[model samples]
Target: MGEDADVATSLADSVSEEIADRLAPVDAELARRYPGEPPTRQPVHTVYVPADAVSSGTVSAWGEQAREMLDEHAPDAVSFASVLGLPSHLAGPVHDRVRAKLEREPVEDLRIDFEDGYGRRPDSEEDAAAARAARLVADAFEDGSAPPCMGIRMKCMEADVRDRGIRTLDIFLTGLVDAGGLPGGLVLTLPKVSHPEQVAAMARLCGEFETARGLPEGRIGFEIQIETTQSILGPDGRATVALMIDAAGGRATSLHYGTFDYSAACGVSAEYQAMDHPVADHAKAVMQAAAAGTGVRLSDGSTNIVPSGRREQVHDAWRHHHALVRRSLARAYYQGWDMHPGHLPTRYAAVYAFYREGMERAAARLAAYTGNAGGDAAVMDEPATARALSNYLLRGLDCGALSSGEVARHSGLTRADLDALAGRATEAQVNSGP
Candidate 1:
C-alpha cells in the first residue's frame, strides 16, 4: 500500500510540471496585458478648465469659490449632512474633512481643456495659448502650487482637426521640454476617440515626441476619451474599447467618459442626458469591464448643472450634484470630472461621506482576514476580498477621507502592511517583511 501511494505522488508531481511548462506563454501574456492596479494615488476627481480661462490662480480661485459656497449654503455639519442625506455619525467627520481638503488640496487633478471647451481659434492664437498653458503649468509645478496631476486635453483626431490637434500637442510638449522638463504629474487627454487606429496614432505621436524631446521612451501617457458609440463597439460587432487599449501600446493611462457628447451621439434629448441615465450606465459598464485589470483607470463623466443664482437654486444644484457623485462612487467609479467651481463642495462631500461611512467595516474585515486581530470575522473573506479591503482603506487614506492614525488604530496595520497585502509592495519590500 505504501509503495502504491509513493508512485501516485510521483506521477502527480510530473503532471504538474508538464502543465506549468505548457502554460508558460499564457502566464507571460497575462502579465503583459493585465499588470494589476498601479500603486500610485489616483485623484478622486478631475477639474476641467478652459485653456483660455486657466490662469496661474485658477486652482486656488476654484477652491475659494467652493469654500464660499459651503459657507453660504451648508455652513455647519448638520446642515451639510441634511442636504446630502448623510447619516448623523458621518456628518461631522465628512464635513470637516471636506473643508480641510478644499483648503489644502481642493483639486487633486486639473485638466486645461483645449478641445470642446476652447473651441476653434486661429493657428497663431491657438499656438500662443498652448505655449502659455505649458508655461503656467510648469511655473505652478515649480512653485509647488500645481495640483497633483495637471495637463491638457487636445482636440480629437478627426480629419478636419487632425493637423491642428497635432500642432497643439507638439507645441505644448515642446514648450514643456524647453521650460526645464515635463512635470512628474503631466497628463494628456485625446478627446472624441472613435477608433483603435486613432489610439494607435496617438501612441505613435507620443513616441515620436519622446524621441524628439529626449525623454524616456514611454514617459508620456494620455487618457482615452470614450465619447462616441463607435468607441464602445465596432461595426464588426466586438468591443472596440479593449482593442483601443491594446492599440495604445502601453501609453493609455485612463479612459474618461464624455457625458453630454456621448448622450447626444446616442440621440438622447438634451434634457434626458445625464450621468445616471440607462445609456450612460451601459457605456460605463463596458468601460469598467474593459479597464478592470489593465492598470488603466476609469473616470466618470460630469454634470453640466452648475450651482448659481438664488440661494434656493444653489442649494438645489448642490443636492443634485451630491447625489450624482454618490451614485458614481457606489458604482466604483472613484474618479470623475468636475466642470464648475461650485461642484467642488458637493464633490468632496460625497467622496468623504462614502469613504468614512464604510471605513470601519472595511478595516475590521481586513484586520480579521490578515490575522492581525483576534476572533474570526462574521463573513469569511478570501485573498481577493482582503486585497479589496486593503485597497479601500488605502484609497481612503490617499484622498484624505480617513486619517492614517485612525486606519492604523482600527486595522492594526500600518501603511506598509496595507501596501503589502494590496499587492503594491515591491519584491524587496515584501521580502523584508514588517
Candidate 2:
C-alpha cells in the first residue's frame, strides 16, 4: 500500500510540471497585460484651467480663493458641518484638514485645457499659448510652486483638428525641452478620444517626440479621455475602452470620464447631465473594468455646477459637489475633475472624511492580518484583502488624511512596512533586504 501511494505522488508531480511548462506563455501574457496597480500617489482631484488663464499663480490663487470661501460662508466647523450635513464627530477634523490642505496643497494635479475650455484660435495664437504654457510650467517647477502633477490637455485627433493637435503638442513638448528639460511631474492628456486608433496615434506621437528630443523611450505618457459613447462600445459591439488601453501600448496613465460629453453623447438633456447620472455611471463602470489591474487609474468626471454667487447658491453647489465626490470615492474612483476654485474645499473635505472615517478600522484589519495583532476570528482576511487594507492605509498617508505617525502607531507598521505589504516596495528597498 505504501509503494502504491508513492507511485501516485510521483505521477502527480510530473503532471504538475507538464501543466506549468505548457502554461508558461499564458503566465507571461498575464503579467504583460495585468501589471497590477502602480505605487504612486494619485491626486484626489484634477483642476482644469483654460490654457490662456493658466498663470504662474493660478495654483496658489485657487487655494486662496477656496480659503476665502470657507472663511465667508462656513466660518466655523459647526456651520460647515451644517452646510454639508457632516457628522459632528467628523465636522471638526474634516473642516480643519480641509483648511490646512487648502493652505498647504490646494491643487494636487493641474491641467491646462486647450480643448473645450479654450476654444480654437488662430494657428499663431494657439502656438504662442502652448509655448507660454510650457514656459510657465517649467518656471513653476523651478520655483517649487508647481502642483505634484501639471500638464496640458490638447485637442482631439479628429480629421479636421488632427494636424492642429499634433502641432500644439509638438510646440508644447519642444518648449518644455528647451526650458531646461521637462518637469518630473509633467502630465499630458488627450481629450475626446473616441477610438483606439486615436489612442495609437497619441502613442506614436509620444514615441516620435521622445526620439526627436533625445529623451528616453516611454518617457511621455498621456491620459485617454473617455467621453464618447463609441469609446465605451465599439461598432463591433465589444468593449472599446479595453482596446483603447491596448492601443496605448502601455503609455496610458489614466482614463478620465467626461461627464457632460458622455452624457450628451448618450442623448441626455443638459439639465439631467451630471457625474452621477445613469449614463455617466455606465461609462465609468466600463472604464473601471477595462482599466482594472492594468496600472491605469480611473478618474470621475466633474460637475458643471460651479460654487459661486450668493451664499445659499454656493452652499447648494457645495452640497451637490461634495455628495458626488464622496459617491465617486465610495465607488473606488479616487480622482475627479474640479472645474472651479470653489470645488477645492469640498473636494478635500470629501477625500479627508472618506479616509479618516475608515482609517482606524483599516489599520486594525491590516495589523491583524500582518500578525501584528491577534486575528479577528469573526473576519478572516485573505492575502488579497490584506493588500487592499494596506493600500487603503497607504493612500490615506499619501493624501494627508492620516499622518505617518498615526498609521505607525495604529498598525504597528511604518510606511516602509506598509509599502512592502502593499506590494509597492521600490527595487532598491527590495534589494536591500531587512
Candidate 3:
C-alpha cells in the first residue's frame, strides 16, 4: 500500500511539473504575441478560396479578380486552392507562376492542396510532384512574400480507398518535409469518415511519421467532411461523429459540410438541393453536433451557382446568397465555400453581417453578466448570447465588416480570450438566437 501511494504521488508531481513547464513557454509566447490585455476582439480573420480558382492559365486573371474581390468584399484572410492546380504538368515554372500570383496579395492564411482536387486517387509521380510544389511554395513564403499561416489538405479516409489515401498522404508529406516544405499545419480532408477507427489510424500515422522525421509529432491536424450516410447515421451517427473527432486526439480544427456528396449519400435524387435545402439542414446538424465543445470550426458547403455575365443578376445573386450565408454565419459557422469568383461578395457579406450582429449581442451579454439578478451563476453564463455575437463578429472580421478598431471598442476582453471564447461558442452553438 505504501509503495502504491508513493508511486501515485510521484506521478502526480511529475504531471504538475510537466504542466508548469509547458505553461511557462505558453505564457511567454502569449505575452510576446499580445503585450497588453488585448481587446476582446480579434483583428485576424480567415476565408476559404477554392483550388480551381488559381490554376495555370487563370493565375494572373484570378489574382486580378481576387484583388478586385477583396477591394469589394474586403476579406481579412484568403487561402488559395493550390499549387497542384497545374495537374501533371510538373514543371517548376507552373509552380513559380502560382507562387508569384499568391505573393501579389496579402492574406492572413493560405491552404494548399497536396493531393489532386476532390478526388482521393493520386499517381506516384503526381504525388511526388505535389510534394515538390509544396516545398517550393514554402520556400517562396520564407522569402517573405507569402502568408504567415499555411495548411495542406490530403486525401480522405474511406475504407476501400484507405490504401490509396495512405499512399497519397505518405508520399506527399514525406516529399514535403524532405524538400523542406513543412507547412505550419497539415489538413486531412477526411471524406466518408464513418468510424472512429479511421480517425485513430490517421492520428497514429501522423504521430509515427512526424516522430520519424523529427518534426512536431502529432502536430498535423485534420478537417473532416461529414458527407456520407454512414458518417451522418452510424449505428448511431451523431455519437460516431463525436467519437471520431475525439479519436483524432484533438487534432481536428474544422468540420465541413460536403453538399454534393452528402446529398448523394442520403439518396436525395434532386440535383439542386442548395444550402437552403432540408437535406442540408440534416447535414449541418450532424456537423454542428460533432463540433460542439471540440474547439473546431464549422463550415457550410459551397454555393454551386455558376455566375452568368449579367452584372445586375450577378449582384442580385450576391445579395440572395449573402443572406443565406449570413444565416449560416449567424449559426456560428465562420467559413463557407465560394464556388465561383462572383460568389466572393456573398461570402464577405455573410461574414460582415455576422460580425455586426455579434457585437451588439456581446455588448448586451456583458451588460447582463454585470447586472443580472438571477442567483444561478450559470445565468451569467451566456454561451448562446456569446455564440450569436461572436459568430457575427468573426463573419464581419472575415468580410471586413468590422475594423480592428471597431472590434476593440465592442468587447473589453483581450484578443486571445475573445478569439478563444468566440471560437468555442461557435463550436458549442447551442443558442437558438435570443
Candidate 4:
C-alpha cells in the first residue's frame, strides 16, 4: 500500500508539472495584463439617493422619510420630492400637484411621467400636459426656489418616438431657459438605450439645443435606463454602465437601473429575485463598468417589492432589498433608487459598508505594497496587484478616498500612472507584483 501511494503521488506531481508547463504562457499573459500592486483602495464617501416614481399630493408620503433618511444618512445625491396623484390623461392636475410639492420642499429634481402625466397618444392634450409639467419644473428652477439639481425623465428616443421625445425635451429645456427657470443642470433620463448611437444622438440634439439657446455646449447630460437584457448581454455583450456615460462624452451624470422593466425584459423567474438574480447582475455590471473611472454616478434600479403587512415583515422586506443594494455598493456601486421610505436605512448601510470596505481594502493594499518590498522598494507589475492599483486610483477618485498626491505618495506612481491607466492601461497591468 505504501509503495502504491508513493507511485500515485509521483505520477500526480509529474502531471501537475506538465499542466503547469502548458498553462504557464496563459498565466504569464494574464500576469502581464495585471501588474504591480493594485492602485490603493479608497473608501466611497458620498452616495446619491433618487426617489422612485409616486403619485400627486403624495410627495409627503416619501418626503418625511427622505428628510429623516437624509438627516441620518446625509446622502450626497437627494431627489427627495416628486409630483404625484394625477390621472393618466390629465396634464393640469399632474402639473399642479408637482407645483404644490415644490412649494412644500423645494424639489431638487422633477420627473415628467409620460404614461401617467400624459396620455398614450401624442395628441394635443398629451403634448399640453407634458409641456405644462416641463414649464412648472423649469419655473421652479428659474425662480431661485428650486433645488440646485434638476432633471426630467422623457420617453424613449426610439425611431418611432424619436421625433416626439426630442421635441418634448427641446420644448422643456427651451421653456426652462426662456422662462428664466433653468436649473443648475439638465439630465435627460432616456429609457431603454439599445445602442451608443442612441445616446450620441441625444447628445447631438442637446448640442443643437445649446446652440439655439446660446447655452454652452456640453451643458446637458444623459441618465440611461438599463432595463433591457440587450443592454446588458445581447450582441453588444459588453454593454457596461460606464459605456452609458462615455456615450455622452463626459456628460452622463448617472446610470439608473430599471428593475421592473429589466426583469420583464430578462424574463426573470421567481419574480421576487429580480434584484439578486442574473438579470440584476448584468444590469449592475453595466452600471458599475460605466461608473468605474467616470465621475458619473450609478444608481441601482428601484426595489418594486414594497413594504408590507406586519411591522416585522415590512422591516424585513426593506432590509432584505436594502441588503441587495449594499451588496451592489460593496461591489462599487454608489447610488440606487428607493421606492419606499423604509428602505432608507438599507441605503445608508450600503454607503457605510462601501466606505468601510474601501478603507480596509485600500489600507490593506497599501500595506501589502509596502510590506512586499521592505517599505521602500518600488512595486513591480503583477496582474492582481496592478488591477488593485488601477482600481484603487479609479475607485479612489469615485469614492473621494485619495487625492492625486496621496495616491502618488502611497503607490510611488504619479498622476501619469492614474491617467495612463485610466486611459488605456490594459487588464494585464492589473496584476503586476509589488
The sequence of per-residue lDDT tens digits that candidate 4 reaches over residues 1-434 is 66556542336667989999999999986554333322323222111222223233333455565445433332222221111111233333223332333236423344555522343563565466556656656655555544334456666867877777776677767767777745654456778787777878877887888888888666676677777666666475565444545567656656777777778776665455466677677668766654654545666666667655664565456566656766776565655665555554444434433443354345345435545332333434454455555555565444333456655555555555554543444345543423
Per-candidate Cα RMSD to the true structure, in Å, reads: 2.9, 2.7, 13.3, 14.0
> Which lDDT value does model 4 have at 27?
90
TM-score of 2: 0.95
Between candidates 2 and 3, which one is better according to TM-score? 2
lDDT (10s digit) by residue, model 1, range 295-406? 8999999999999998789888989999999999999899999988889989988988888888888888887887877524898999888888888898889899988998
Model 2 misplaced stretches (Cα beyond 4 Å): 1-7, 10-13, 374-377, 427-434
Model 4 misplaced regions, further than 4 Å = 1-61, 65-110, 115-122, 139-148, 233-250, 270-273, 294-296, 353-434
301-336 per-residue lDDT for model 2 (tens digits): 999899999999999999999999999999999999
Candidate 1 versus the native: TM-score?
A: 0.95
> What TM-score fits each model?
0.95, 0.95, 0.67, 0.58
